[model samples]
Target: MNQPLTLEELKQVMAEADLLKTEADVEAALDKLAQEITARISESLPVVYGIMNGGLVMAGRLLTKLNFPLEQGYMHATRYRGETTGSTDLQWQAPPSVPMAGRTVLILDDIFDEGNTLAEVVKACHAQGAKEVLTAVLVNKVHDRKNTELKIDFIGMDVEDRYVFGCGMDYRGFWRNAAGIYAVKGL
Candidate 1:
Protein backbone atom coordinates (compact mmCIF):
# COMPACT_ATOMS: atom_id res chain seq x y z
CA MET A 1 0.00 0.00 0.00
CA ASN A 2 1.10 3.55 -0.65
CA GLN A 3 1.59 6.01 2.16
CA PRO A 4 -1.09 8.65 2.48
CA LEU A 5 -0.06 12.20 1.69
CA THR A 6 -0.16 14.84 4.35
CA LEU A 7 -2.42 17.82 3.80
CA GLU A 8 0.54 19.94 2.82
CA GLU A 9 1.75 17.34 0.38
CA LEU A 10 -1.68 17.13 -1.24
CA LYS A 11 -1.78 20.89 -1.61
CA GLN A 12 1.65 20.82 -3.21
CA VAL A 13 0.57 18.17 -5.64
CA MET A 14 -2.53 20.12 -6.58
CA ALA A 15 -0.51 23.28 -7.04
CA GLU A 16 1.68 21.52 -9.58
CA ALA A 17 -1.13 19.65 -11.30
CA ASP A 18 -1.90 20.44 -14.92
CA LEU A 19 -5.14 22.24 -15.59
CA LEU A 20 -7.16 20.19 -18.07
CA LYS A 21 -10.40 22.16 -18.19
CA THR A 22 -10.76 25.80 -17.25
CA GLU A 23 -13.82 27.17 -15.46
CA ALA A 24 -14.97 28.79 -18.68
CA ASP A 25 -14.66 25.47 -20.47
CA VAL A 26 -16.69 23.74 -17.78
CA GLU A 27 -19.40 26.40 -17.97
CA ALA A 28 -19.62 26.04 -21.75
CA ALA A 29 -19.91 22.29 -21.42
CA LEU A 30 -22.69 22.59 -18.84
CA ASP A 31 -24.52 24.94 -21.17
CA LYS A 32 -24.30 22.42 -23.97
CA LEU A 33 -25.42 19.58 -21.74
CA ALA A 34 -28.37 21.61 -20.57
CA GLN A 35 -29.34 22.32 -24.15
CA GLU A 36 -29.17 18.68 -25.14
CA ILE A 37 -31.11 17.55 -22.08
CA THR A 38 -33.79 20.15 -22.72
CA ALA A 39 -34.18 19.13 -26.34
CA ARG A 40 -34.36 15.45 -25.46
CA ILE A 41 -36.57 15.29 -22.35
CA SER A 42 -37.73 18.74 -21.33
CA GLU A 43 -41.36 17.81 -21.66
CA SER A 44 -40.98 14.74 -19.49
CA LEU A 45 -40.93 15.06 -15.71
CA PRO A 46 -37.68 13.24 -15.06
CA VAL A 47 -36.10 12.44 -11.72
CA VAL A 48 -32.53 13.70 -11.82
CA TYR A 49 -30.19 11.82 -9.53
CA GLY A 50 -26.73 13.11 -8.84
CA ILE A 51 -24.33 10.30 -8.07
CA MET A 52 -23.23 11.95 -4.86
CA ASN A 53 -20.01 13.68 -3.89
CA GLY A 54 -18.51 13.68 -7.39
CA GLY A 55 -21.69 14.44 -9.27
CA LEU A 56 -22.82 17.25 -6.97
CA VAL A 57 -20.89 19.93 -8.81
CA MET A 58 -21.99 18.91 -12.28
CA ALA A 59 -25.58 18.39 -11.26
CA GLY A 60 -25.80 21.71 -9.46
CA ARG A 61 -24.22 23.56 -12.35
CA LEU A 62 -26.42 21.89 -14.91
CA LEU A 63 -29.55 22.44 -12.87
CA THR A 64 -29.11 26.18 -13.14
CA LYS A 65 -29.17 26.03 -16.92
CA LEU A 66 -32.19 23.80 -17.21
CA ASN A 67 -35.46 25.69 -17.59
CA PHE A 68 -37.93 22.83 -17.33
CA PRO A 69 -39.49 21.37 -14.20
CA LEU A 70 -37.73 18.36 -12.73
CA GLU A 71 -37.31 16.54 -9.45
CA GLN A 72 -33.79 16.15 -7.97
CA GLY A 73 -32.23 13.63 -5.63
CA TYR A 74 -28.88 11.99 -4.90
CA MET A 75 -27.44 8.47 -4.93
CA HIS A 76 -24.33 7.59 -2.99
CA ALA A 77 -22.44 4.75 -4.64
CA THR A 78 -18.72 4.54 -5.03
CA ARG A 79 -15.87 2.23 -6.01
CA TYR A 80 -13.22 4.59 -4.69
CA ARG A 81 -13.85 5.81 -1.18
CA GLY A 82 -10.82 7.97 -0.57
CA GLU A 83 -8.22 6.14 -2.62
CA THR A 84 -6.58 7.02 -5.88
CA THR A 85 -7.79 3.85 -7.59
CA GLY A 86 -11.07 2.00 -7.59
CA SER A 87 -11.80 -1.39 -6.12
CA THR A 88 -13.50 -4.36 -7.76
CA ASP A 89 -16.70 -4.05 -5.80
CA LEU A 90 -19.03 -1.09 -5.68
CA GLN A 91 -20.51 0.00 -2.35
CA TRP A 92 -23.93 1.56 -2.25
CA GLN A 93 -24.20 3.72 0.84
CA ALA A 94 -27.46 5.27 -0.28
CA PRO A 95 -29.86 4.78 -3.16
CA PRO A 96 -32.16 7.30 -4.74
CA SER A 97 -34.92 8.33 -2.36
CA VAL A 98 -37.26 9.66 -5.02
CA PRO A 99 -39.98 7.63 -6.66
CA MET A 100 -38.66 6.26 -9.96
CA ALA A 101 -41.43 3.86 -10.97
CA GLY A 102 -42.58 4.40 -14.52
CA ARG A 103 -40.74 7.71 -14.69
CA THR A 104 -37.96 9.09 -16.80
CA VAL A 105 -34.67 9.26 -14.87
CA LEU A 106 -31.56 11.24 -15.54
CA ILE A 107 -28.40 10.15 -13.76
CA LEU A 108 -25.53 12.61 -13.62
CA ASP A 109 -22.00 11.79 -12.59
CA ASP A 110 -18.54 13.34 -12.69
CA ILE A 111 -16.51 11.01 -14.91
CA PHE A 112 -17.07 7.91 -16.95
CA ASP A 113 -13.85 5.99 -16.53
CA GLU A 114 -14.39 2.20 -16.50
CA GLY A 115 -18.19 2.30 -16.85
CA ASN A 116 -18.70 0.01 -13.86
CA THR A 117 -20.52 2.22 -11.36
CA LEU A 118 -22.64 3.99 -13.94
CA ALA A 119 -23.67 0.72 -15.57
CA GLU A 120 -24.82 -0.72 -12.28
CA VAL A 121 -26.67 2.46 -11.38
CA VAL A 122 -28.45 2.45 -14.72
CA LYS A 123 -29.47 -1.15 -14.16
CA ALA A 124 -30.80 -0.30 -10.73
CA CYS A 125 -32.88 2.50 -12.18
CA HIS A 126 -34.38 0.13 -14.72
CA ALA A 127 -35.07 -2.37 -11.98
CA GLN A 128 -36.97 0.32 -10.14
CA GLY A 129 -39.28 0.58 -13.19
CA ALA A 130 -37.83 3.69 -14.73
CA LYS A 131 -39.46 3.98 -18.15
CA GLU A 132 -36.40 5.69 -19.61
CA VAL A 133 -32.88 6.16 -18.24
CA LEU A 134 -30.46 8.79 -19.44
CA THR A 135 -26.92 9.46 -18.28
CA ALA A 136 -24.71 12.51 -18.31
CA VAL A 137 -21.16 13.03 -17.21
CA LEU A 138 -18.92 16.03 -16.83
CA VAL A 139 -15.91 14.22 -18.20
CA ASN A 140 -15.55 11.07 -20.30
CA LYS A 141 -12.16 9.42 -20.09
CA VAL A 142 -10.91 8.29 -23.46
CA HIS A 143 -10.00 4.77 -22.52
CA ASP A 144 -10.39 1.28 -23.97
CA ARG A 145 -11.11 -0.47 -20.68
CA LYS A 146 -14.87 -0.01 -20.50
CA ASN A 147 -16.66 -2.97 -18.93
CA THR A 148 -20.10 -2.35 -20.39
CA GLU A 149 -21.85 -1.45 -23.64
CA LEU A 150 -23.54 1.53 -22.03
CA LYS A 151 -23.27 4.80 -23.87
CA ILE A 152 -23.43 8.13 -22.05
CA ASP A 153 -26.30 10.27 -23.37
CA PHE A 154 -24.63 13.59 -22.62
CA ILE A 155 -21.01 14.57 -22.03
CA GLY A 156 -19.27 17.76 -21.04
CA MET A 157 -15.75 16.97 -22.18
CA ASP A 158 -13.53 14.14 -23.33
CA VAL A 159 -10.37 13.87 -21.29
CA GLU A 160 -7.27 11.79 -21.77
CA ASP A 161 -6.95 8.59 -19.79
CA ARG A 162 -5.46 10.23 -16.73
CA TYR A 163 -6.39 10.48 -13.07
CA VAL A 164 -8.30 13.71 -12.78
CA PHE A 165 -9.59 15.80 -9.85
CA GLY A 166 -11.60 18.96 -9.25
CA CYS A 167 -15.04 20.07 -10.33
CA GLY A 168 -16.40 17.66 -7.71
CA MET A 169 -13.81 14.88 -8.30
CA ASP A 170 -11.48 14.43 -5.36
CA TYR A 171 -7.81 13.60 -4.98
CA ARG A 172 -7.40 11.85 -1.62
CA GLY A 173 -10.75 13.40 -0.64
CA PHE A 174 -9.70 16.94 -1.41
CA TRP A 175 -9.74 19.47 -4.26
CA ARG A 176 -13.32 18.78 -5.29
CA ASN A 177 -14.08 22.48 -4.98
CA ALA A 178 -11.35 23.59 -7.35
CA ALA A 179 -12.32 25.95 -10.14
CA GLY A 180 -11.63 23.50 -12.96
CA ILE A 181 -10.60 19.97 -13.79
CA TYR A 182 -6.96 19.02 -13.28
CA ALA A 183 -4.81 15.97 -13.89
CA VAL A 184 -2.15 14.90 -11.47
CA LYS A 185 1.37 15.11 -12.81
CA GLY A 186 3.27 11.82 -13.18
CA LEU A 187 0.43 9.81 -11.68
Candidate 2:
Protein backbone atom coordinates (compact mmCIF):
# COMPACT_ATOMS: atom_id res chain seq x y z
CA MET A 1 0.00 0.00 0.00
CA ASN A 2 1.09 3.57 -0.64
CA GLN A 3 2.06 5.59 2.40
CA PRO A 4 0.00 8.62 3.27
CA LEU A 5 1.54 11.98 2.47
CA THR A 6 2.84 14.21 5.25
CA LEU A 7 1.71 17.81 5.53
CA GLU A 8 5.02 19.18 4.28
CA GLU A 9 5.09 16.76 1.37
CA LEU A 10 1.57 17.74 0.39
CA LYS A 11 2.51 21.41 0.57
CA GLN A 12 5.50 20.82 -1.65
CA VAL A 13 3.33 19.01 -4.17
CA MET A 14 0.90 21.94 -4.21
CA ALA A 15 3.69 24.47 -4.59
CA GLU A 16 4.96 22.68 -7.68
CA ALA A 17 1.49 22.22 -9.17
CA ASP A 18 0.70 23.57 -12.64
CA LEU A 19 -1.98 26.22 -12.49
CA LEU A 20 -4.72 25.09 -14.82
CA LYS A 21 -7.60 27.42 -13.98
CA THR A 22 -7.11 30.55 -11.89
CA GLU A 23 -9.63 31.65 -9.30
CA ALA A 24 -10.97 34.36 -11.57
CA ASP A 25 -11.45 31.90 -14.39
CA VAL A 26 -13.40 29.55 -12.17
CA GLU A 27 -15.58 32.38 -10.93
CA ALA A 28 -16.28 33.54 -14.47
CA ALA A 29 -17.35 30.05 -15.46
CA LEU A 30 -19.66 29.82 -12.48
CA ASP A 31 -21.22 33.15 -13.40
CA LYS A 32 -21.94 31.85 -16.88
CA LEU A 33 -23.35 28.63 -15.50
CA ALA A 34 -25.61 30.58 -13.16
CA GLN A 35 -26.98 32.63 -16.03
CA GLU A 36 -27.62 29.54 -18.15
CA ILE A 37 -29.27 27.67 -15.32
CA THR A 38 -31.43 30.63 -14.46
CA ALA A 39 -32.56 30.97 -18.05
CA ARG A 40 -33.47 27.29 -18.28
CA ILE A 41 -34.90 26.40 -14.87
CA SER A 42 -35.26 29.46 -12.69
CA GLU A 43 -39.02 29.38 -12.46
CA SER A 44 -39.23 25.63 -11.90
CA LEU A 45 -39.19 24.41 -8.33
CA PRO A 46 -35.93 22.55 -8.79
CA VAL A 47 -34.32 20.47 -6.07
CA VAL A 48 -30.57 20.97 -6.27
CA TYR A 49 -28.60 18.01 -4.97
CA GLY A 50 -24.90 18.35 -4.34
CA ILE A 51 -22.78 15.22 -4.64
CA MET A 52 -21.13 15.71 -1.29
CA ASN A 53 -17.50 16.18 -0.27
CA GLY A 54 -16.40 17.10 -3.78
CA GLY A 55 -19.54 18.92 -4.86
CA LEU A 56 -19.93 21.08 -1.76
CA VAL A 57 -17.91 24.02 -3.01
CA MET A 58 -19.43 24.10 -6.49
CA ALA A 59 -22.95 23.74 -5.14
CA GLY A 60 -22.49 26.50 -2.56
CA ARG A 61 -21.05 28.87 -5.13
CA LEU A 62 -23.87 28.14 -7.56
CA LEU A 63 -26.70 28.50 -5.02
CA THR A 64 -25.78 32.13 -4.32
CA LYS A 65 -25.83 32.98 -8.02
CA LEU A 66 -29.30 31.58 -8.56
CA ASN A 67 -32.02 34.19 -8.00
CA PHE A 68 -34.99 31.87 -7.71
CA PRO A 69 -36.12 29.92 -4.69
CA LEU A 70 -35.15 26.22 -4.68
CA GLU A 71 -34.52 23.39 -2.27
CA GLN A 72 -31.00 22.11 -1.56
CA GLY A 73 -29.64 18.78 -0.34
CA TYR A 74 -26.53 16.61 -0.57
CA MET A 75 -25.71 13.00 -1.37
CA HIS A 76 -22.46 11.19 -0.59
CA ALA A 77 -21.45 8.86 -3.39
CA THR A 78 -17.82 8.24 -4.14
CA ARG A 79 -15.52 6.05 -6.20
CA TYR A 80 -12.38 7.52 -4.68
CA ARG A 81 -12.54 7.60 -0.92
CA GLY A 82 -9.13 9.26 -0.48
CA GLU A 83 -7.03 8.10 -3.40
CA THR A 84 -5.70 9.76 -6.49
CA THR A 85 -6.96 6.91 -8.66
CA GLY A 86 -10.44 5.43 -8.81
CA SER A 87 -12.00 1.99 -8.48
CA THR A 88 -14.73 0.48 -10.58
CA ASP A 89 -17.11 0.04 -7.67
CA LEU A 90 -18.99 3.01 -6.25
CA GLN A 91 -19.83 3.33 -2.59
CA TRP A 92 -22.88 5.25 -1.51
CA GLN A 93 -22.36 6.59 1.97
CA ALA A 94 -25.51 8.68 2.10
CA PRO A 95 -28.51 9.41 -0.09
CA PRO A 96 -30.23 12.74 -0.61
CA SER A 97 -32.55 13.67 2.23
CA VAL A 98 -34.99 15.74 0.23
CA PRO A 99 -37.80 13.97 -1.60
CA MET A 100 -37.51 13.81 -5.41
CA ALA A 101 -40.76 12.20 -6.48
CA GLY A 102 -42.45 14.06 -9.32
CA ARG A 103 -39.95 16.92 -9.02
CA THR A 104 -37.23 18.42 -11.14
CA VAL A 105 -33.81 17.51 -9.73
CA LEU A 106 -30.44 19.03 -10.49
CA ILE A 107 -27.25 17.16 -9.61
CA LEU A 108 -24.13 19.26 -9.11
CA ASP A 109 -20.67 17.76 -8.92
CA ASP A 110 -17.01 18.83 -8.92
CA ILE A 111 -15.89 17.13 -12.14
CA PHE A 112 -17.24 14.89 -14.85
CA ASP A 113 -14.35 12.52 -15.42
CA GLU A 114 -15.52 9.03 -16.38
CA GLY A 115 -19.22 9.93 -15.89
CA ASN A 116 -20.04 6.75 -13.95
CA THR A 117 -20.91 8.39 -10.66
CA LEU A 118 -23.07 11.08 -12.21
CA ALA A 119 -24.82 8.50 -14.37
CA GLU A 120 -25.67 6.38 -11.34
CA VAL A 121 -26.96 9.37 -9.39
CA VAL A 122 -29.23 10.40 -12.24
CA LYS A 123 -30.59 6.88 -12.48
CA ALA A 124 -31.30 6.85 -8.75
CA CYS A 125 -33.27 10.09 -9.02
CA HIS A 126 -35.25 8.70 -11.91
CA ALA A 127 -35.92 5.50 -10.03
CA GLN A 128 -37.41 7.57 -7.26
CA GLY A 129 -39.82 9.09 -9.82
CA ALA A 130 -38.13 12.41 -10.51
CA LYS A 131 -39.88 14.22 -13.35
CA GLU A 132 -36.59 15.44 -14.75
CA VAL A 133 -32.91 15.19 -13.90
CA LEU A 134 -30.30 17.76 -14.84
CA THR A 135 -26.56 17.58 -14.38
CA ALA A 136 -23.81 20.19 -13.85
CA VAL A 137 -20.10 20.08 -13.19
CA LEU A 138 -17.45 22.62 -12.22
CA VAL A 139 -14.92 21.03 -14.57
CA ASN A 140 -15.38 18.66 -17.46
CA LYS A 141 -12.27 16.55 -17.93
CA VAL A 142 -11.32 15.74 -21.51
CA HIS A 143 -10.82 12.00 -21.86
CA ASP A 144 -11.74 9.09 -24.09
CA ARG A 145 -12.73 6.69 -21.32
CA LYS A 146 -16.41 7.00 -20.49
CA ASN A 147 -18.89 4.46 -19.15
CA THR A 148 -22.15 6.36 -19.21
CA GLU A 149 -24.41 7.95 -21.80
CA LEU A 150 -25.43 10.87 -19.58
CA LYS A 151 -24.55 14.38 -20.69
CA ILE A 152 -23.69 17.27 -18.42
CA ASP A 153 -26.16 20.12 -18.97
CA PHE A 154 -24.06 22.91 -17.46
CA ILE A 155 -20.26 23.04 -17.55
CA GLY A 156 -17.99 25.53 -15.83
CA MET A 157 -14.83 24.74 -17.78
CA ASP A 158 -12.89 22.12 -19.71
CA VAL A 159 -9.57 20.79 -18.42
CA GLU A 160 -6.91 18.66 -20.01
CA ASP A 161 -6.35 15.18 -18.64
CA ARG A 162 -4.44 15.55 -15.39
CA TYR A 163 -4.60 14.70 -11.73
CA VAL A 164 -6.27 17.86 -10.49
CA PHE A 165 -6.88 19.00 -6.95
CA GLY A 166 -8.48 22.11 -5.43
CA CYS A 167 -11.77 23.94 -5.77
CA GLY A 168 -13.53 21.05 -4.03
CA MET A 169 -11.16 18.41 -5.52
CA ASP A 170 -8.59 16.83 -3.24
CA TYR A 171 -5.06 15.46 -3.22
CA ARG A 172 -4.80 12.48 -0.89
CA GLY A 173 -7.98 13.77 0.79
CA PHE A 174 -6.61 17.27 1.26
CA TRP A 175 -6.41 20.66 -0.54
CA ARG A 176 -10.05 20.76 -1.55
CA ASN A 177 -10.17 24.29 -0.12
CA ALA A 178 -7.49 25.66 -2.47
CA ALA A 179 -8.82 28.71 -4.34
CA GLY A 180 -7.71 27.68 -7.82
CA ILE A 181 -7.64 24.47 -9.82
CA TYR A 182 -4.22 22.82 -9.94
CA ALA A 183 -2.70 19.81 -11.62
CA VAL A 184 -0.06 18.09 -9.56
CA LYS A 185 3.43 17.99 -11.01
CA GLY A 186 4.74 14.61 -12.27
CA LEU A 187 1.45 12.87 -11.52
Candidate 3:
Protein backbone atom coordinates (compact mmCIF):
# COMPACT_ATOMS: atom_id res chain seq x y z
CA MET A 1 0.00 0.00 0.00
CA ASN A 2 1.14 3.53 -0.61
CA GLN A 3 1.68 5.89 2.29
CA PRO A 4 -0.94 8.55 2.87
CA LEU A 5 -0.28 12.02 1.54
CA THR A 6 0.42 14.64 4.22
CA LEU A 7 -2.14 17.35 5.00
CA GLU A 8 0.09 20.12 3.63
CA GLU A 9 0.76 18.09 0.53
CA LEU A 10 -2.92 17.50 0.02
CA LYS A 11 -3.53 21.21 0.34
CA GLN A 12 -0.76 21.91 -2.14
CA VAL A 13 -2.22 19.41 -4.55
CA MET A 14 -5.47 21.35 -4.68
CA ALA A 15 -3.68 24.68 -4.70
CA GLU A 16 -1.80 23.85 -7.87
CA ALA A 17 -4.65 22.04 -9.61
CA ASP A 18 -6.32 23.61 -12.62
CA LEU A 19 -10.02 24.24 -12.32
CA LEU A 20 -11.69 22.53 -15.23
CA LYS A 21 -15.38 22.86 -14.32
CA THR A 22 -16.97 24.94 -11.61
CA GLU A 23 -19.67 23.71 -9.25
CA ALA A 24 -22.26 25.56 -11.28
CA ASP A 25 -21.01 23.87 -14.40
CA VAL A 26 -21.38 20.46 -12.84
CA GLU A 27 -24.86 21.29 -11.57
CA ALA A 28 -25.99 22.38 -15.01
CA ALA A 29 -24.61 19.23 -16.50
CA LEU A 30 -26.56 17.17 -13.99
CA ASP A 31 -29.70 19.02 -14.96
CA LYS A 32 -29.11 18.20 -18.59
CA LEU A 33 -28.45 14.55 -17.77
CA ALA A 34 -31.55 14.28 -15.64
CA GLN A 35 -33.65 15.57 -18.51
CA GLU A 36 -32.10 13.23 -21.02
CA ILE A 37 -32.42 10.23 -18.75
CA THR A 38 -35.99 11.12 -17.90
CA ALA A 39 -36.91 11.46 -21.54
CA ARG A 40 -35.63 7.97 -22.20
CA ILE A 41 -36.64 5.97 -19.11
CA SER A 42 -38.60 7.97 -16.60
CA GLU A 43 -41.57 5.71 -17.01
CA SER A 44 -39.62 2.47 -17.28
CA LEU A 45 -39.09 2.45 -13.53
CA PRO A 46 -35.46 1.56 -14.08
CA VAL A 47 -33.24 0.15 -11.37
CA VAL A 48 -30.51 2.76 -10.89
CA TYR A 49 -27.19 1.55 -9.55
CA GLY A 50 -24.54 4.02 -8.60
CA ILE A 51 -21.04 2.61 -8.92
CA MET A 52 -19.78 3.41 -5.45
CA ASN A 53 -17.04 5.78 -4.30
CA GLY A 54 -16.64 7.87 -7.44
CA GLY A 55 -20.34 7.79 -8.26
CA LEU A 56 -21.47 8.82 -4.81
CA VAL A 57 -21.66 12.56 -5.38
CA MET A 58 -22.88 12.44 -8.98
CA ALA A 59 -25.57 9.89 -8.21
CA GLY A 60 -26.83 11.71 -5.14
CA ARG A 61 -27.19 15.03 -6.90
CA LEU A 62 -28.51 13.55 -10.14
CA LEU A 63 -31.04 11.36 -8.36
CA THR A 64 -32.77 14.32 -6.83
CA LYS A 65 -33.13 15.98 -10.21
CA LEU A 66 -34.50 12.90 -11.93
CA ASN A 67 -38.10 13.64 -10.86
CA PHE A 68 -39.10 10.07 -11.47
CA PRO A 69 -39.78 7.11 -9.23
CA LEU A 70 -37.03 4.49 -9.47
CA GLU A 71 -35.21 2.06 -7.26
CA GLN A 72 -31.82 3.36 -6.20
CA GLY A 73 -28.97 1.04 -5.19
CA TYR A 74 -25.18 0.79 -5.27
CA MET A 75 -22.41 -1.60 -6.29
CA HIS A 76 -18.79 -1.32 -5.20
CA ALA A 77 -16.70 -2.74 -7.99
CA THR A 78 -13.33 -1.06 -8.34
CA ARG A 79 -10.11 -1.31 -10.32
CA TYR A 80 -8.31 1.62 -8.70
CA ARG A 81 -8.83 0.84 -4.99
CA GLY A 82 -7.55 4.36 -4.27
CA GLU A 83 -4.58 4.38 -6.64
CA THR A 84 -4.36 6.68 -9.65
CA THR A 85 -3.90 3.82 -12.11
CA GLY A 86 -6.24 0.87 -12.30
CA SER A 87 -5.28 -2.72 -11.60
CA THR A 88 -5.98 -5.42 -14.16
CA ASP A 89 -8.49 -7.21 -11.99
CA LEU A 90 -11.73 -5.70 -10.71
CA GLN A 91 -12.43 -6.12 -7.02
CA TRP A 92 -16.08 -6.51 -6.07
CA GLN A 93 -16.20 -5.12 -2.57
CA ALA A 94 -19.99 -5.32 -2.78
CA PRO A 95 -22.37 -6.70 -5.32
CA PRO A 96 -25.58 -5.14 -6.59
CA SER A 97 -27.80 -4.08 -3.72
CA VAL A 98 -31.00 -4.81 -5.63
CA PRO A 99 -32.07 -7.44 -8.11
CA MET A 100 -32.11 -6.38 -11.75
CA ALA A 101 -33.67 -9.49 -13.27
CA GLY A 102 -36.04 -8.58 -16.12
CA ARG A 103 -35.61 -4.93 -15.30
CA THR A 104 -34.11 -1.90 -16.96
CA VAL A 105 -30.83 -0.98 -15.31
CA LEU A 106 -29.09 2.37 -15.30
CA ILE A 107 -25.51 2.64 -14.07
CA LEU A 108 -24.17 5.95 -12.83
CA ASP A 109 -20.50 6.78 -12.45
CA ASP A 110 -18.24 9.82 -12.00
CA ILE A 111 -16.09 9.44 -15.07
CA PHE A 112 -15.71 7.26 -18.14
CA ASP A 113 -11.93 6.95 -18.25
CA GLU A 114 -10.64 3.75 -19.89
CA GLY A 115 -14.14 2.13 -19.74
CA ASN A 116 -13.01 -1.12 -18.10
CA THR A 117 -14.78 -0.69 -14.76
CA LEU A 118 -18.09 0.42 -16.27
CA ALA A 119 -17.96 -2.25 -18.97
CA GLU A 120 -17.55 -4.97 -16.37
CA VAL A 121 -20.38 -3.58 -14.28
CA VAL A 122 -22.71 -3.56 -17.30
CA LYS A 123 -21.84 -7.13 -18.06
CA ALA A 124 -22.55 -8.14 -14.50
CA CYS A 125 -25.94 -6.48 -14.74
CA HIS A 126 -26.70 -8.42 -17.91
CA ALA A 127 -25.64 -11.66 -16.30
CA GLN A 128 -28.06 -10.84 -13.51
CA GLY A 129 -30.84 -10.71 -16.15
CA ALA A 130 -31.33 -7.03 -16.75
CA LYS A 131 -33.49 -6.43 -19.83
CA GLU A 132 -31.33 -3.48 -20.82
CA VAL A 133 -28.38 -1.63 -19.32
CA LEU A 134 -27.53 2.02 -19.83
CA THR A 135 -24.60 4.09 -18.64
CA ALA A 136 -24.21 7.69 -17.52
CA VAL A 137 -21.11 9.58 -16.47
CA LEU A 138 -20.34 12.95 -14.99
CA VAL A 139 -17.26 13.33 -17.16
CA ASN A 140 -15.80 11.52 -20.16
CA LYS A 141 -12.02 11.71 -20.30
CA VAL A 142 -10.99 12.32 -23.90
CA HIS A 143 -8.42 9.77 -24.99
CA ASP A 144 -7.97 6.58 -26.96
CA ARG A 145 -7.07 4.24 -24.11
CA LYS A 146 -10.55 2.75 -23.78
CA ASN A 147 -10.44 -0.97 -23.04
CA THR A 148 -14.05 -1.61 -23.98
CA GLU A 149 -16.44 -0.70 -26.79
CA LEU A 150 -19.21 0.24 -24.37
CA LYS A 151 -20.64 3.70 -25.05
CA ILE A 152 -21.89 6.05 -22.40
CA ASP A 153 -25.58 6.84 -22.88
CA PHE A 154 -25.35 10.12 -21.06
CA ILE A 155 -22.33 12.33 -20.39
CA GLY A 156 -22.24 15.56 -18.44
CA MET A 157 -19.13 16.88 -20.11
CA ASP A 158 -15.87 16.05 -21.84
CA VAL A 159 -12.55 16.78 -20.22
CA GLU A 160 -8.98 16.70 -21.46
CA ASP A 161 -6.95 13.62 -20.69
CA ARG A 162 -5.43 14.48 -17.35
CA TYR A 163 -5.47 13.18 -13.81
CA VAL A 164 -8.64 14.76 -12.46
CA PHE A 165 -10.25 15.09 -9.04
CA GLY A 166 -13.36 16.62 -7.52
CA CYS A 167 -17.14 16.05 -7.88
CA GLY A 168 -16.49 12.66 -6.33
CA MET A 169 -13.28 11.84 -8.24
CA ASP A 170 -10.20 11.75 -5.99
CA TYR A 171 -6.54 12.59 -6.07
CA ARG A 172 -4.68 9.85 -4.18
CA GLY A 173 -8.12 9.17 -2.66
CA PHE A 174 -8.39 12.72 -1.42
CA TRP A 175 -10.27 15.85 -2.65
CA ARG A 176 -13.38 13.97 -3.65
CA ASN A 177 -15.28 16.73 -1.87
CA ALA A 178 -14.02 19.52 -4.07
CA ALA A 179 -17.06 21.30 -5.57
CA GLY A 180 -15.42 21.85 -8.92
CA ILE A 181 -13.65 19.49 -11.29
CA TYR A 182 -9.90 20.00 -11.26
CA ALA A 183 -6.94 18.56 -13.09
CA VAL A 184 -3.84 17.80 -11.06
CA LYS A 185 -0.87 19.93 -12.00
CA GLY A 186 1.97 18.11 -13.79
CA LEU A 187 0.10 14.86 -13.79
- Structural similarity to truth (TM-score) of each candidate: 0.92, 0.93, 0.94
Q: Which structure is stronger by TM-score: 1 or 2? A: 2
Q: Among all windows of ten consecutive residues in candidate 1, which has the lowest summed lDDT? A: 81-90
lDDT of 2 at 150: 85
Best by TM-score: 3
Write candidate 2's Cα lDDT for 1-187 as tens digits: 6688998999899989999999999999999999999998888999999998899999998899999989998899867676757675667889888999999999999998889878878888898999999999999999998665888999999999999998899987799999899999987
Better of 2 and 3 by lDDT: 3
Residue-by-residue lDDT tens digits, candidate 1, 42-101:
999989999988999889889989899999999998777767677856678897889899
Q: What is the lDDT of residue 95 in candidate 3?
A: 91
lDDT of 2 at 94: 93
Count of steric clashes across candidates, in order:
0, 0, 0
> Which residue ranges in model 3 land beyond 4 Å of their true spot?
80-89
In candidate 1 the C-alpha lDDT for residue 52 amounts to 88
* Best by the lDDT measure: 3
- lDDT tens digits by residue: candidate 3, 1-187: 7787999999999999999999999999999999999999999999999998999999999999999899999999978787868886778899999999999999999999889888888888898999999999999999999866798999999999999999999998799999999999998
lDDT of each: 0.90, 0.90, 0.93
Location of the lowest summed lDDT over 10 successive residues in candidate 3: 80-89
Instruction: State candidate 2's TM-score.
Output: 0.93
